[model samples]
Target chain A: MSVAGSDFAVRVEGLEKSFGHWPVLWDLDLTLDWGQLLVLFGANAVGKTTLLRILSTQARPDAGTLSVAGYDPVRTPNAVRRRIGVVGHQTCLYDDLTCRENLVYYGRLFGLTDIPRRVDEAISRVSLGHRADQRVRTLSNGMQKRASIARAILHRPPLLLLDEPEAGLDQESTVMLQGLLKEWAESGGAAIMTTHNVDLGLAWGETGKIGVLADGKVQVQEPGRYANVAEFRQVLSSSLVTRQRN
Target chain B: MVLVWKDILLEVRSRELVISVLVFGLLVAVVFNFALDVTPQRVTAIAPGILWVAFAFAATMAMSRAFVREREQGGLEGLLLSPVSRDAIFLGKALTNLLFMLLVEMVLLPVFAVLFGFSAMSFTLIGTIVLATLGFSLVGTLFSAIAAQTRSREIMLPVLFFPVILPVIIGAVEASTRAIGGETTVGLGRWLPLLAVFDALFLVICPWVFSFVVEE
Candidate 1:
């Protein structure tokens, strides 16, 4: 099937997926424009990673009408993969390889020209130039996350699909992420990051949209509409409580 | 076995996997030499079986580790997320596994020669090794990727591996025996062409199947 919109970074309608008998996501609809940032918040096991996996072409939806970067994920996965970058809980860097080596490897995989220059630029972009020579196993969690971010943007992809990018980040790494996100917005590239921290999620989309996945569907709102974080927290707790009750 | 990644991963890799395969192969040769009592008359028959068994089992065990690093470090997802064709990913990995298995086989061949009382060097035996290793390594590499995704990968690999590679095991043994016996036409001529056919067939099928195996 042909994608209707050429502008949306991601568009999903009535997406459904399940593991065995447990339904993780059903009839879920969401969209992110190329110039917007979307922060997706959900409780543990609420299919946050599953949704991101579908978008990244790592997992297939049981049923859905979906388009990522104007390409159907299953029909044209390579095209979709080319248009997107992904960062999950794992660093995706080889432990045996140095940080610079990891970026250069990805640069070659993505068929980027001027690889040494791109690797240098990406390493510097994440402020990993000093430690770029070290193997990934030697780096701390924060440094690895920074290197992962470098790998993600090594191809200069138009969209970034991040799954809980802030889970264990320290203050410095978190601050580095904020700068990256700010630059991500400024570059007009789209991003959909799954996060559990309400404050962090809301902060990610400062002026953009924040979404909550509950009962197999998402309810999105502009954080600007809420008076403070507590309001959004109340709504989130109430919805999750309602789900648990059912 | 080695990783594929456009051959760049070779530079970063440690020597552990190579050492593992070589040592495992030599262990098989040593055990077989002590376990069996073979004179020159039986050497042609029994030695070929022992040699291929060493190569097949050792290569199977070693090739399974090829994807462990990728899966454990979550780098497989990174590869899947790339714009590179899935077929290229599979072929590159299968070919690299082939390369590594050949390297270990070269190291072990002389050891097997001393143990089994056979000539160390023969073009026909080398040809048989290359063709047969290619077939099994392609199948092994594909199964490694599949088994790596599952929870009981260790159990899954052998359960899935031995049955599929039985043909290569038989073909290599037959061809190696003929190559060692200096029969230029009878068994080697028949088995070599057949082994090449199987290699070509696996070379085509494994990569295509690998695309689906990696998908969720």
Candidate 2:
């Protein structure tokens, strides 16, 4: 509601995005602030990924005022990019480069001076130090996902845009990722992650927001509510039927 | 500088583009030898065309490989998400493609000289090659980025690339033909100017086009 204020990390007002004539997001609005992790739940083709792309400044909205860290994504993309880290469905890792090389590459993008030490720290953070020298193509899908997380957090961006960061992760990696995110949020950083797994999505960040997107709108937005997964699931299923029928 | 270094480093480590382009260019020259059966007298006439055609094909191979690598691994989005300006990224990639093509040409030129029985070393010839390769790589890098986003990227790159680069190839071939004919002064007159103008035009245009393409 108060997206323009400096307290908020992401602010979207009247956002609309479409591919050609097919509209994906229609008159949607959302707000997120630092020290919170918002888990967005949506059905397939509900424009969750498109929304994330717009927010991350990789795609433009057809019409809307979308800002990340108080900078407009369309006009001030570079400024917005400097403040955010995105981990999408794609691992975004070079198949030929080893895990350490990939991390070091991203570190250099962020202008980190001591790349070797930072790369080692990130590799150990994701628990991938054992396979640091291994090519990404040779690593497991779960390991690749960990490497993506490592790359994203290397610069310690203020806002994190995660589109299904947990998709390929195993139980141990998932737990480690959650721990890292929790620590980040506790330290006043913000994140918005989209997921199909309602259980895992709802379980994230107790005091944060749970938004259900259906039919190109935020069908159910219960910010600071639905602390438990069972309650969130019940509301989500009913909201889906009601929103689809409407 | 970092973007260009990363690309060169990746290619060096992988050895994917250089090895394949070198072999491909050599094979094209070998094919030309058997197909044409040119005598020493006819070497200057046919060799320039053969050399440029071979370079064009090899350059296209490198162009496709460079652009597609980022998309195949989803690294393009990571690049777009970085704070670096799009112009820098475009220049870095163009430089890398140029470097790859030049490296292949460096090897192929000497081999072609041996096979065709012509002395290939000349300042004018090297100058023409540099100018032509710059223009070729700039357009190729821009179009390759455009093609990489499409469903049929491999098919799309050459379709978008070759027609646009005809002026460059023709200019290079003509200038190179004269240089090999031992007429350096005349070769630098019309065709070299053409190559320089084309290179300068793309040096301004490609980066702008690349920024627009990646922004969308």
Candidate 3:
């Protein structure tokens, strides 16, 4: 539960992983600072989620090193877990528990003091207070996603790992999420978010890094590399097509 | 404690595990009461075996149910993603299963007594039940974690659970039979302590094994 004295929020180098005969992430390298956000883009079956899993200490890599908040994931996974909050595709909320109950359970798991206050704060952060008492199974998909986000940020960790966090969100909810994330980034928390929406990813990463994952590697680009979204979109499409051809 | 609290809350809300296992245990006793040709002479011996079988199958059913909620709903992943240690998760789950099995046993023990025509309820029998249930719950919780990772988990749980817990079941049957027959010497001399030994051994080993296997 102790934070390592490192400037970077996440660091990975020469990382490799595969499922059976299909390689997902190979020789992938990434680094994010404490106040930065990285929006990862890839094809449908690419290794974006896989990489996030490895970074979050949920999965081990086949080779290379992973450091989250300056601690090695393989050796000190609990420390890494203590420092990061993840919003995965699964929602990770118990269907039978109310949104507040789910947050309370997770808050207890993280060993947070003053759980009721923390739970209320997280629900407010996600704007889920109106539906906080409803069971997760009874909520809309968008509402459930917000609840999941609430659970993720309940601990107020230094890092956030989000996989398709905006998948089922409506326009307003998505904007709210963006605003929350913007505030999170501004408050010196780091995040790595993956999405299929290229324009959205570009917009989100405009202040940090945008990464295109293709052919077992990531091509990371800084915001200043391109002047506009269309140019960046063309470059990304061509890179993906070329990688697919290879 | 928090994990167990959540499990208890869920069970309280759903009434799934205890109710299903209670009904299943009762059905087993009923079926055996009719299926077996138990004369007064054989009732002492035969009833013990039937009771243990009922308890074992019911405990196995409970074990399967325990993990299905977590696995089917991605709750296990959520647990892993949290800051809790694996040992806490294993102990919490095993304790909940033990509590649940004990609850089912309390209701079924008397019903079995009525169905099989024996005076029931004693400290010896209760102690024996606790020891036996502890052993199997410890082992079953570990195997349940393993089986939850497999495809045919419904079949896999019993297939993996029964053989590993045979000693506990046998000990339970022996101790229950002696306790019912009022053979304090035999019940205390061998079976109860043996069940305790198995429980202790599994209490140490299962959590260790669980820590190793719980990681995917």
Give the number of the best model, judged by DockQ: 2
Of 1 and 3, the candidate ahead on DockQ is 3
In model 3, the Cα lDDT at residue A221 comes to 71
- DockQ, prediction 1: 0.63
What candidate 3 gets wrong by more than 4 Å, as runs, is A1-4, A222-228, A235-246
Model 3, A125-210: lDDT tens per residue?
88888889988999998898888888888888888899988799888788888887788788888898988776677678877788
lDDT of 2 by residue, A1-246 (tens): 122356788878889988998888988888888888888887677788899888888888888787788889899988888788889988889898899888888888877888898888888999998999998989999999999998988877888889988898899998897888788788888888887676677678465777888767764466437676567577666643434422
Reference contacts recovered by each candidate, as fractions? 0.86, 0.81, 0.67
The full ranking of all candidates by lDDT, starting with the best, is 3, 2, 1
Each prediction's Cα lDDT score? 0.82, 0.85, 0.85
The candidate with the higher DockQ, 1 or 2, is 2
Clashing pairs in 2: none
Best by TM-score: 3
lDDT of 1 by residue, B138-192 (tens): 8899888888878998889888988988888888898888888875557566788
Q: Name the lDDT value of residue B30 in candidate 1.
A: 77
Predicted complex 2: CAPRI docking category: medium
